[model samples]
Target: MSNSLFQPITLGHLTLKNRIVMPPMTRSRASQPGDVANELMATYYAQRAGAGLIVSEGTQISPLGKGYAWTPGIYTPAQIAGWRQVTDAVHREGGVMFVQLWHVGRVTNPDNTGGAQPISASAVKAENVKVFVDNGTDAPGFVDVVAPREMTKADIQQVIAEYRQSALNAIEAGFDGIELHAANGYLINQFIDSESNHRTDEYGGSLENRLRFLDEVVGALVNAIGAERVGVRLAPFTTLNGTVDADPQTTYTAAAALLNRHKIVYLHIAEVDWDDAPDTPMTFKQAIRAQFDGVLIYAGRYFTQQDQAAKAELAIASGLADMIGFGRPFVANPDLPVRLAQGFPVATHDPDTLFGGGEKGLTDYPVYQAAK
Candidate 1:
């Protein structure tokens, strides 16, 4: 039987050895204050080099875009120098890593953003969602989430410039390519959500207007990094951040159709994960495929059932998604491909170290020696 998970995938000019992708996961362990990418980050990623592709954690473009002080960035000289070492290490271990560029939008608190007010699609504050303040424990100088400053026409254009510049920085820092983080409840998403965006400006109202910022930024990224090396991740209309959109299907379909037109290297959709989805999931597989000729990678929480994997393979084989991602299982079992191949029970991930932590759950997960 052909190992679908281990099969090769052609992502534009780049050829992945397997379909397994270590999608961008924020470790939140960068050295504090400056949030420099140290040797630890490099070693952590090198351990996962067996995957076909590895997308690094969300890296901020400029100082203002940083929501968490501990996360890494691609802007500063010291940061670039630090990340260069990480890229060099991953390359030495036979890995291809792309930096996921992000702008936090209104999620930022003024206290953490170097005194700058958090900016979003509108001046609306996020309710019910709890953002990580300073730290999880001890003193934890956290504050209630506040509404963000609505960006002016000039601010919107400047943000796009940041995306382009960030792509340039990623290439110079020795990354394989760039992934525009239009997912999560971040800045791009704020602009995409109808409830969050309530302006009569050019960037609000209709789906085309809402998609304008993302389109401009993505177009700028392609211009900087080339279409062959650029990719995008979208969350559609669903909200994991305690916020919901009025019409998700209309939102995601329009976004997917517009993105597919770019012919990017791939579109990593935040597809169905939860069974009790209050908002019905939109299957843009046909729509996206009709519009795009590149790859489609679907992710967001899945199990390793043989029947499930087989069904997924059939869908991929039948042209639904080119690649499927397994997050938690892979986090615990570094040899997830091998375990799945042998139909062995997958190891459980340590919930303790899933977020902020040391090497215990980060790189200490033992691989099946036989696979080695």
Candidate 2:
């Protein structure tokens, strides 16, 4: 049973150290006023370079894309310089990394960007939302989420360009690739949900029409970089925080089919875990596999290895996900693949301070090297 964890896997152009991938986890440590990555954030990412592939935290694509306080962005020159530090460190350690480009859509408050209203596919807002407000270089406050202006055709085209520009910026900052934040209740997801997107134009009504925004953004990223350099994330049926989708099976199936048409890189899907029910309808790792012949990754709340979980391989070995992402397990054990290979006991993850804080529960977590 000596299955290898140090074996290399070719994911498009990047060759990972092993098959392990560090999933995108938001750590709100961006320097204030401009949301630039800092020395602390750089060193923090470097500490976990043992991962075969590191998908850096969800980074804002523009000022309008940010929803939370202290989240890093890739739009500014300073922010690009800051991310360069992070990418350099990860590269120095022989790890491949990708940047997840994000836009919050209606999930934002005007307070975060000096009273700029959030923009969404439609003029709808999440029932309950919170966002960070910058008072000075040091003081950022969290406030209520306000309704966003419904995007006009001009806004749509402008945001697509913003995505293209941000992708170019990510390359300049030394990212090997890019992942679109089309999941959660963010911009792309807002458009995907029939309940959220109530537009009457070409961008709404049917599945194909509703999928126009993602199509445009992804196409722009592919044009900026290349189709082989772009990947996307989706949370098919998440009912989180009063967010609802009409039919997840129809939603994700059509989405998967649509994604197959484009020459993109990979698709990462998350099954929601609300009230203990599966989030993605269809679990069509099989259906998606039948549709798109590309790399697939799946992650959610379930991460245990007792008997290796029969249902786990239903995605990976059974042809749904080419690779699997371990979130909580990776958070606790930096040397996760190593421990998993040897069947070593995993370190317990701390429940407190998952967000909004210092490095106490963050980068200070030691790898097995230090544990020895």
Candidate 3:
């Protein structure tokens, strides 16, 4: 049976060549001291241009938004120029790319934020979680997260402005679109999830209030770069980085409905991918599909690492997802679309060089070669 994964789909003004998406996976390889994107990053993205659509790694909107050391940023002129190199490289290879805009609310400590206390929906600490920072050594350093200061109304407005500017910056950097990092317990996730958000203001408390920040941010992005070029990612089931909504179905279903109102280009759902992770209910998937009318992308352990092609095909065939994002597989198999379409064996990536590194595991992955 032929797979629907290779079918071309229209998203906004662009027609994607296929449904295979390379979802954003953070690799802390940005130029240090300035966190700028460079030729190395460009080479990495251009190598994976086989993907129908590529979402760049999580990029901080401002210095304060940074959580991990060496991750790229979009706020500075040098950073924007750096990303231009990446976008230009990807474009040269005929790939469509969207930058993932991020802000790690309470997911950081003073070390990563230049001595500034991390800010969140409330003064809460993400227990049992550690973010990576530069230890001024060869190896990346991990430290416990400190309790964040409750964001003031002024602070919230400023962050929203930063997001708006970041979207504009993305366009200037030559990206086709932008994806708001509203998932994975980031800044936006910090506000959306019930467990982490303990606020009485309009940005929290009630379900509608909890969704206000998301609404504002999406509106800002849409206004800055049009709704057709905007996308959002949500993690409804995972308690990653200490974001736990009391009722995920109710919460995320409402969230889907909210994105529908914005009419964003797509809604990406990041499912829990760890081994032994609970399956995301079909009912919830159906609910989200029902709520959001645009393109729907589902990523994360869709079966097993090796069986991604089979499971991803099944997902698109089931009508629940319009596209599939292969994260780790894309890392090890730069020619992932060709390999999956032709049933070539995929290569496994090295866990050691996954994060902060040079070209070893980054762009060294080769295209599959069949036995002659």
Instruction: Give the best candidate by lDDT.
Output: 3
- Global lDDT of each candidate: 0.77, 0.78, 0.93
Candidate 3 residue-pair clash tally: 0
Task: Let me know the TM-score candidate 3 reaches against the reference structure.
Answer: 0.98
Q: Against the true structure, what is each candidate's TM-score? A: 0.91, 0.91, 0.98
> What digit string (tens of lDDT, one per residue) describes model 2 on residues 53-161?
7788899988888887789999999999999999998888777889999988888777765579889888887887666655444334667788889999999998899
Q: Per-prediction count of colliding residue pairs? A: 0, 1, 0
Poorly placed runs, candidate 2 (over 4 Å): 1-7, 132-142, 279-283, 305-314, 369-372
**Alpha carbon deviation, residue 188, candidate 1 (Å):** 0.7
lDDT (Cα, tens digit) per residue for candidate 3, span 30-109: 99879999999999999999888999999999989999989999999999999999999999999999999999999987
RMSD (CA, Å), each prediction: 2.6, 2.6, 1.0
Task: Compute the lDDT of residue 164 as modeled in candidate 3.
Answer: 98
Which residue pairs clash in candidate 3? none
